[model samples]
Target: MTLFWAGAYALTRVAVDKGNPDMGLPVAWVLPGRLTIGAAVLWVLMLARGQKLPPLRDRKRWVAIIGMGLAGSVFPFFLITTAQETVNSSLAA
Candidate 1:
């Protein structure tokens, strides 16, 4: 976990560095791509584990799930990667 986080911080730092225009990925592209791939992998794993989402009709539970996902998962990563654009990896992480 430590290594992965370190790498993520380091890599996003490089990726979002606009000073190196030729080598850097666009900031707009990185977050969504990372999130989409992560979501895909998680979906596969959940299926493999025989897990299922709460029914769509369970509106409160569904809302809670979405809210927690946005707050806990997506928001933090978004903030970290965006911050990485302006600061050193260690500082951003």
Candidate 2:
């Protein structure tokens, strides 16, 4: 999780830097690509280590994942990445 978070931070930093402050590029393209790449890497790591994720058998857990993915991951990632284009890392953080 620590490493993944670090990767996320680095990714956002790079994305903001590359696109510049105006953010004229497509965030729809940007956000999903970053997420897909991260997800693929995580999936590969799990497979390589013979690790299994928890089954989404419970409604609460399912809700939690969805909520967190949207609220915590996607939303904040977009907001911070976009904001970082105009703001410093300290201010964004």
Candidate 3:
């Protein structure tokens, strides 16, 4: 997890740096693509391990899951991506 987290910042920096007038790749596109790919990979791994999806009918569970996703995943990614626009990736990390 630590290594993956570090690598994410480094790779995000690379992506941002590579963006220019010609390429015009925004952080908006990059961040969601990264998240989607990560989620897909995790879903595949869970399936490979024979993991079952939890019941979505449970409202409280859904709330907690959403909260965690926003707090743990989405928020941090947005913050980092926004910061990386000005801050050095190494410093951001």
> Worst 10-residue stretch by lDDT in candidate 1?
18-27
Model 2 regions more than 4 Å off: 1-14, 17-24, 53-59
In candidate 3, what are the lDDT values of residues 1-93, reduced to their tens digit?
899988887888777764342453578888899989999998999999999777988889889988999999899888898777667778889
Report clash pairs, candidate 2: none
Position 86, candidate 3: lDDT: 66
Residue-pair clash count for candidate 2:
0
Judged by TM-score, which candidate is best? 3
Give me candidate 2's TM-score against the actual structure.
Answer: 0.61
Which residue runs of candidate 3 sit more than 4 Å off their true CA positions? 1-3, 18-24
Worst 10 residues of 2 by lDDT: 18-27
TM-score of each: 0.82, 0.61, 0.83
- Give the higher-TM-score candidate: 1 or 3: 3
Alpha-carbon RMSD, each predicted model:
1.9, 3.7, 2.1
